[model samples]
Target: MDPTNSSTSLAFEVAVFNPSIIVGPVVLGALVDTCLFGCLVIQTYVYYANFANDHRAIRFTVAAVFATQIAHVMCVSATLWNTAVSAYDDPSKLQMLPLASAATILFTGITGALVESYFAFRLWNVSKKLLLPILSMVLCVIAQVVSLVITVQAFKTTSVAEFEVDQNTPITLALTSRVLCDLILTLSTAWYLKNQRSGYLRTTNMIDRLVLWTIETGLITRYDERRRSWRV
Candidate 1:
């Protein structure tokens, strides 16, 4: 490669790696997640606030739920910021991208799993009838870990910089775990809402909408999963 041509090609790559373009979506997603999770936190607090005879466990549960959501939002935002800046700084460096990508993907899945576990706890508290939800969540965790291991192995391929990762690698694992987690959480909420001793209309509606948004965000609808969607 001619030195001058190589420099020009590298400059074009830098220009295409504009931080603003990709960062905008990340920031937007973070804000939307914040809004949804924040609303849930407030809703949970209000539900507990009116408890004239609140148990210690209920209070503790409320606190744990709030903390989990906050932690997830913060982790996601931090990951986005790190990934965006690193990409802008060195677009051609696959190693750097993978570092941030792996962290973001792993933490995001873990956060979602924790959220599902919390909901599972709530389901068990509400009804002894459905041990199935908790079982499903446990199975999902096992599957997610297996997928993550495969993705890590794929990244170990020599000259990953020249090799584009298909949707079947780490990204797929992350999204699959995320969707399954959302499904578990959504089912738990639906079960609770249906079986509530006295339903609160506002809270039920909010939970429904939030879970729907979660499903939409977590599931990669841009590509068809039923068909193998990849080009490399």
Candidate 2:
């Protein structure tokens, strides 16, 4: 090949692989997250509005989840703008914003911890045993620690690529742990609830519905967490 042609080809490749191109996908992911959060907000509002007669604890949990989700949405938007518009036309400035990124990560961890612990509370209610609930709580703690560490490390690094290269293990493990914990909680709760069925047609049907609801929520959230972590 001609030397000049080779040089031009190399330059083209370099330009194609700029940090901006990589950051584009992250921005898109953040936008999608914002949309999902909006949906969550709407759902929370409707639930609270319609179910005002629910237990105080249930209402409080719903409020807390929605609140944290709002915080996460705000932080993520700020971070996206900081990494995109404010730093536009400059690929080197494609760095993560420390405050926004950190806050977003912390919010996610707290949200997951809250969700898992709440279900652990349910498990406690069913079994009256401390061990299972405590185990689930421990997994949540570990997952959150890993998540926060990944966020802090990402901000400290120069680019997303670098962060992934350095922290991929923790990233994968954190998500895996989170999913496993949710699954365990889901299965255990469903099993215990199933055992409570008194064999009467009406009561058995009600228990079946509860089991279905638990499985559905469990799988949906588990899938969502996996998707979010993969994006990160």
Candidate 3:
């Protein structure tokens, strides 16, 4: 083979792969993830500082979630480094999914499930209703299992194209379950809180604020999941 011809062919193939399409999103995601991690750190600090007298189970849960978040950040950072730096001139390397990338899926699912479970518990405590919280937990488990399957398939796949083709159904299922779970939690909590309003100005205001917060957070998460589905 003529050396020049071989080099030109590889370049053409790399161009077709469009590294920017992959690298751009990865970089943007990592930056957003890091920013969110910073927020979590601040929140964790505040929780420990102000809620020192919280129940042991609650404190332990907070600590565990914080640790998981740290690991998630590390995995995301590694994936970013691999995509933007380590794989910089190698299109084949870019095409293959990094181990860290797959690991991030697992970690993300874990962190999400834990947080959702905690919220579901809180909903159950306040509303004294078992159905919504139970449904939320079930959805969380489904999403988590789907994530695990995706991660495992990612490990087995040799390239991004292959993984996407194979995991499309699971990905859709996972996103759907997550959005549903968030929706249930948000609406149920807001409804229960609204019903608890005692007509006292101060107490009603507090409940109103909580309802707004729940709805806002739920919409944000649902929107995010929808975006992910669009991307997929």
Candidate 4:
């Protein structure tokens, strides 16, 4: 526990609390996320410059998305710092504090919910119906609530494995809801767009583009879900 020992004793070797590939992958992922966030920032700038000039609501949505993503990236960075440096020597520090995961999970859930809700709004606009969109929004809200519950359970549990076991029900519920929400949003949007396909070449091409965008968004959501569940 000596302050000087961290510098001399644990400086050269991987601590028992962490694995070899751990920090590398986290740092790499953080870098990738930051780069992607930068791209989002640029896109936000362009949207503000071009699209935001006319639509007040769209501009607000764009800003909300950007801010939520920024919060997510910042949480990711803080979690990395906690894992990589704060617990380098103190094994006790390696134990879950619940704060880090709590903040990150809450932020992630909010971001995912916002994105899905936006897509659901788009679908509602297209379908001119409230049934499916309302369902999707409800699922997204449930998932976010379940994520926060996981955070609370993690705080109550002692170890990571114990936390996972204790919260398995809520965890599975949250993830399942997320996946289902994504599927619904993607499929519904694509189906709606497909239905819009008319003999008119220009309109059909526009629907095609919208369908592609919907597919891409779903793929990204699936990837994020996998990454969240991949923890040891």
What is the lDDT of every predicted structure here?
0.61, 0.81, 0.89, 0.77
Return the TM-score for each candidate structure.
0.48, 0.68, 0.78, 0.70
Candidate 4 deviant stretches above 4 angstroms: 1-25, 154-158, 202-232
Model 2 agreement with the true structure over 48-85: per-residue lDDT tens digits:
78999998988898889989998998898888887778
lDDT for model 4, on a 0 to 1 scale? 0.77
Cα deviation at 25, candidate 1, in Å, is 3.2
**Model 3 — which ten-residue stretch has the worst lDDT?**
9-18
lDDT tens digits, residue span 85-184, model 1: 6556664442333443444445454555556666666666666656656675775676568556644654554323322344346556556665765676
How does candidate 3 score on lDDT?
A: 0.89
Q: What is the TM-score of candidate 2? A: 0.68
The superposed Cα distance between candidate 4 and the true structure at residue 203, in angstroms, equals: 8.5
Candidate 1 wrong stretches, greater than 4 Å: 1-21, 44-48, 51-58, 79-95, 98-107, 124-127, 143-167, 181-232
**Candidate 3: regions farther than 4 A off:** 1-18, 198-232
Q: Model 3, 16-84: lDDT tens per residue?
A: 555668899999999999999999999999999999999999998899899998999999999999998
- Cα deviation of 17 in candidate 1 (Å)? 9.1
Candidate ordering by lDDT (highest first): 3, 2, 4, 1
* Model 4 C-alpha lDDT per residue in residues 123-161, reported as the tens digit of each score: 999899999899998999999899988767665664544
* Candidate 2 pairs with clashing backbones: none
How well does candidate 1 score on lDDT at residue 91? 47
Model 3, residue 153: distance off in Å is 1.1
Give the least accurate 10-residue stretch of model 4, judged by summed lDDT.
9-18
Better of 1 and 3 by lDDT: 3
